[model samples]
Target: MKKLLIASALLAASSIQQAHAWGQTGHRITGAIAEQYLSEEAKAAIAALLPNESLAEASTYADEMRSNPEEFWQKEAGPYHYVTVPKGETYKEHKHAPEQGDAYTALKKFSKIVKDDTAPLSERQRALRFIVHIIGDLHQPLHAGDGTDKGGNDFKLEFFWEKSNLHRVWDSGLLDRRQLSYTEWTEWLSEKITPEQAAKWNTTDPLIYITESATIRDTIYPEGDRLGWDYLYQHLPTAKVRLQEGGVRIAAHLNELFAK
Candidate 1:
């Protein structure tokens, strides 16, 4: 019965991946950065989003930064993004079915620090950079997860050949599906970016972005009792689309944030 229960739980958990909070298509870029906002690594992950002076310059900047990251990002990051979230708190959702941890609240808190001129330049710079990175994270379906799971980590499934957890799928599995480099993929996805996307991605309200991604979460995958290559095949495009959107939106937001 224990084994049976375990299997049953796995099956039930499998269904959870396709649910609204778990969205079916996964596209996560995992590194030291991923969802983290504090690590020096996180700041490094987003260096590509910073200003490049021109598209030609952007490519040059990306090339130089990736090739010689130590010098570039060290020169770029602020002190605040280096500090971890205060103890006993999380960016996780922990609330009733109707209401949860406020993502907007989180954003406002961070933004105040960024906008505050009195803060040290390092802190302010980190805050600005993190705001750009978090907006990208906020759009990922699982990041605005349902309260029961740790951004879909508890949910499990099989992808391609191996058994995997739902959160992991979004964290890297699906994003890996496209063999193309980020630049190639960005070109395909950005072509369709609408004026509406531009207007919407500019919203600095963290809660609003959370709600927006949460709504997007619903359209991402199949319901319960399903997850496999077939599902992945059908949904991987959406994963690419989200990453593409996030990358473009990142560029847009950074451009606007610094333009100010």
Candidate 2:
């Protein structure tokens, strides 16, 4: 009975991944990697906000909130997970936030809440979970959409034998196939970055991060709708780098938030 319950929960979780930000493992991997680069001060600050949880564990809260019964989580939180940048336009050119805020706008708002000592602790806690998740969201190329394609959600394709869409492929199809737990993936990717690499990738500006993703998104569409081993081979490195940068930048942002 216990095994059946666990399998059922896993099945339910899998169904939701196709429509959301990076699947659970991808977000957790970003969170875990960010854990490695955090300062002692940042870690302590996070502990105060989260009590028993680490940033890695808190990383999926925003996504998980979708399952929540609250109206804000079910409806208003949709736009906070991604931003659409039409082709030939920069985020600045496309700067208007819908009634529902986009990830870039939400990042700016949450950063202030997390850093403000004057804010209610409860509010700050909510903000910090969002801060961790949205950073990972901004790093996924498809999350920075090209306006027309629904971020490639409308682009139908077959990933191996399974019917899927481009957005879902980037969200989890590639990373899930590797079968590494988030911690293992984080450790593996974290080792590949050197001091120089870290310095080059760490940036506080959210817009720059969005731009990097937007540029990559434009270049990554396959000529054919069929994606298999070769397609994964060509783009997997790109995904790894984005994940690496997302982790490093999450740490950088947290360090700045908590710096005394």
Candidate 3:
């Protein structure tokens, strides 16, 4: 038991390395919003896969795995969180996927597992958790990456006088500053999603999410390494849309998966 506790600590410590999608709060918001759109069939299937878990709770599992002692969790999962797209090009235009793996590739891999009825229960459950998280990560602009700066992780700045990076700013800094709980964000975004909007947002293609993120990412850099109200005013809407889209699309993905 002591050894297990020590390993858990190590995993928790490693989670601080990458800001990750919209951070935990953001992912939960996305997950909660997704709950609104899930079909009865999809809901029942998900319950079987994760008897005790909600989609929102499962949505951060991939990020949390960063702390695990397994090499696959520690090393292999890195590329699955983001994909590098060079400046001035789209993901399809660049045709890039890390040799090891990437979000798009990982999505394809895990998604297949989620859909395969023949797969072991344990494997499908793990894949379902990854699918939930990766869909959320896919919507975070930085997760699409612009090969120039480690997805803005390399771009240093002062966000409201606090030393931070462009990636961190987008991940959670702006949302955190608002001081809203994930449930509040979910409630607000959920009301705004009209059926027309949800239909348009629901798609299985990760490239659409990646391309949109990469395009938006290009325009989000702060001019003077100092970001304040002006930055928030201009970009917060985009961030909210991405979060909303993540939730709606995740619901669509699951609906299609279990619709079989």
Task: Tell how far residue 210 is off in model 1, in angstroms.
Answer: 1.8
User: Which sequence of candidate numbers ranks them by lDDT, best first?
Assistant: 3, 2, 1
Q: Report RMSD for candidate 3.
A: 4.8
Residue 189 miss distance in model 3 (angstroms): 1.0
56-79 per-residue lDDT for model 2 (tens digits): 888888887777768777667768
Q: Where does candidate 3 clash, by residue pair?
A: 11-67
lDDT of each: 0.46, 0.87, 0.88
Model 3 misplaced regions, further than 4 Å: 1-17
Candidate 1: stretches off by over 4 Å: 1-103, 194-202, 218-226, 244-260
* Pairs of colliding residues, candidate 2: none
Sort by TM-score, best first: 3, 2, 1
